[model samples]
Target: MMKRIPIALYFLLAGLCAAAQPKKLDIVFIGNSITQGGGLQHPLEEAPPVKAWEWLKRAMPGSNIQYSNQGVSGSTTVDFLPATNKLFNNVVKAADAFKADKDATLVFSMVLGTNDSAIEGPNGSPVSPEQYRLNVKAILDQLLSSYPGCIIILHHPTWYSPNTHNGARYLAEGLARLQSYFPVLDAIVAGYRSTHPGQVYTGYTGGFSYFKKHPELFIQENGRSGVFQLHPNAKGAAELGVFWAQAIKKVVGRLK
Candidate 1:
């Protein structure tokens, strides 16, 4: 029995050494109000404090991770394109500190294009479907060029409430429904994946199909018909944040 003590101690020490190595992870989330956290069914409901990245961090305890929420409410893809914001300098330099750490695995998630289709107020103007594609491509090309090894995931935009009375779906071009342009995202990302192969992927969050079946989960406010539902309330956020995190975890797992 005494002789076996040394052998057991050796194995225990090895396990400790292996467990001491920390995994490095970095994530960046980009989009508009939906991505940032907005839209509630009730006028009295408060915003959900936890977002997708925060929920993800909570999910994985004792892991080395760096994350940032770059979501800007009421902003369109044009805000991210050239002649607008300095995505690399602002996003990478300001928000993404992990970019400095060469050893860290980087993941970028984009949930945009909703505001691009807005027709309300002075700022609202729907972008042409083709232009939207080009803007997205520009965003990707810049990111990949900066971090050649980074992993990219395109999140499908959330579904708009069918109730047209609220007028949030007001269109700047085309037949009027702003959500129709969403499918262009799939096409653009699909082409991106084909050329980039394993480095890029599309994380289908089922936003459109989901809310359609479970409209109760969405916030319905404004207008007698109650048509404003481009955002999810606290309950919606929790469900969505969790679902998206699952997709993110899958991609993060492939980092090694």
Candidate 2:
């Protein structure tokens, strides 16, 4: 006959088991048109945020996930600046809602700078690389203060045709400016390593170069300048979603 285990010991063992399980995730995606699935048939269902959440579900079985899409058309980093209280307020509300889930880990996945690089049209078009870095840092500072312990992932914005000119004018010069922001993002993440430690990370650096090589993945639009590729097609959105999910998983796994 086996001896009975003490009640206290039994409860401790159960607690240990629960602690070893995967933690639930609550993500807030902040970006611009591409993130919102601007050219997609049904943005509500086909948006990159939705796709990323779907991919994460399959990739991390048994983990509960929730997300909010805060992408706005024609939005720039300046639009998300803390002083604006425009887009940033909405982002706060979304993150606060997720706070109700005490068991879930909060994460902010951001992709901006597309419209910021535009020569015109966007609110803060032609934003210099220095201003762009400051804007992003300010946004992150407010977010960190508002939601302590939340993870922040800054992604490199994807590519658009050199001739991209519709509501906004992003010619070859604009594309070059967009590329300049990449190094700024890298520096920002590096700075956070010392200040915020593991709370901040650089995410999905491949999109810019990857999309540049595959024009087929993007939808060709009849712009003022002519045909141009900006937003990704459905297949591209799915792939982009996978890219985000991979980066998120890497960060979370590292912390785990």
Candidate 3:
């Protein structure tokens, strides 16, 4: 009787350990030029998504992680809307590519709104806060419907100089408008608790506040207004990736 009891306990422990093992991650990054690693010398290697994947590799050693960077230059929430059939379709394609890995859990990480707040550039310039909320919701709705088991993480857009005016014009007013979207994003994620449950979450919201305090992280550029900072330098991109990886790690942990 004692030998039989030991065998049963061993099997139970083994099952628990197997269940505790981490699942492979298949992440699809969706956003704008910042996410595309715009103006970087080696965007493919130095991009935030790549850096985030690197971070996860180190943190979880031996875990399988795959990512696709689908960020488009000058894209907006409006451009990614379901009806547009442009950027949104690309995202769907990217997600579909990972469907073959049945053992992998899918995740979508998004960062946008920099161009949307612009006074004059991007597909949807000067997007009202209300409109931005609706646009984001619509995108999330489609994503959730399509990838029912996947997780979606909405990252608030980072900081840009108030006088930023190169191809687009995001002055002080634009910055204010950009800040307004923060709360809206939070509300959207919170609302999903009742609607989508644990499928949707907010990720890495410290970029704006952190970059505001540390301007050196940004790549200083000459805009129409004067010298301005919008994109992140290599170091900044690495740090931003860490932010995302940490957030993702937490979300992944919850799954276990």
lDDT of each: 0.66, 0.92, 0.89
| lDDT tens per residue, model 2, 66-176 | 899999988999999989879999999999999988788899999999999999989988999999999999999999998889999999999999999998899999999
Q: What is the lDDT of residue 175 in candidate 2?
A: 99
Q: Work out the TM-score per prediction.
A: 0.75, 0.91, 0.91
Q: How much is 234 displaced in model 2, in angstroms? A: 0.7
Count of backbone collisions in candidate 2 = 0
User: How well does candidate 1 match the true structure in TM-score terms?
Assistant: 0.75
**Candidate 1, superposed: residue stretches over 4 Å from native:** 1-22, 39-49, 58-62, 86-89, 120-124, 164-183, 223-227
**Which numbered prediction scores highest in lDDT against the true structure?**
2
Clashing pairs in 1: 41-219, 41-220
Summarize candidate 1's per-residue lDDT along 1-256 as a digit string, tens digits.
4555588899898666445433666778777777667664431223322355566677556557666767666767777774465443556663347767877778887777667765553133467777778888888888887788887888877666545334445422422444565677767767876677666777755877786677676667675355556567677877776667777776665554
State which candidate, 1 or 2, has the greater lDDT: 2
- Off-target runs (Cα >4 Å) in candidate 3 are 1-21
Clashes of each: 2, 0, 0
* Candidate 1 lDDT for residue 177: 40
The reply for model 2, stretches above 4 Å from the true place, is: 1-22
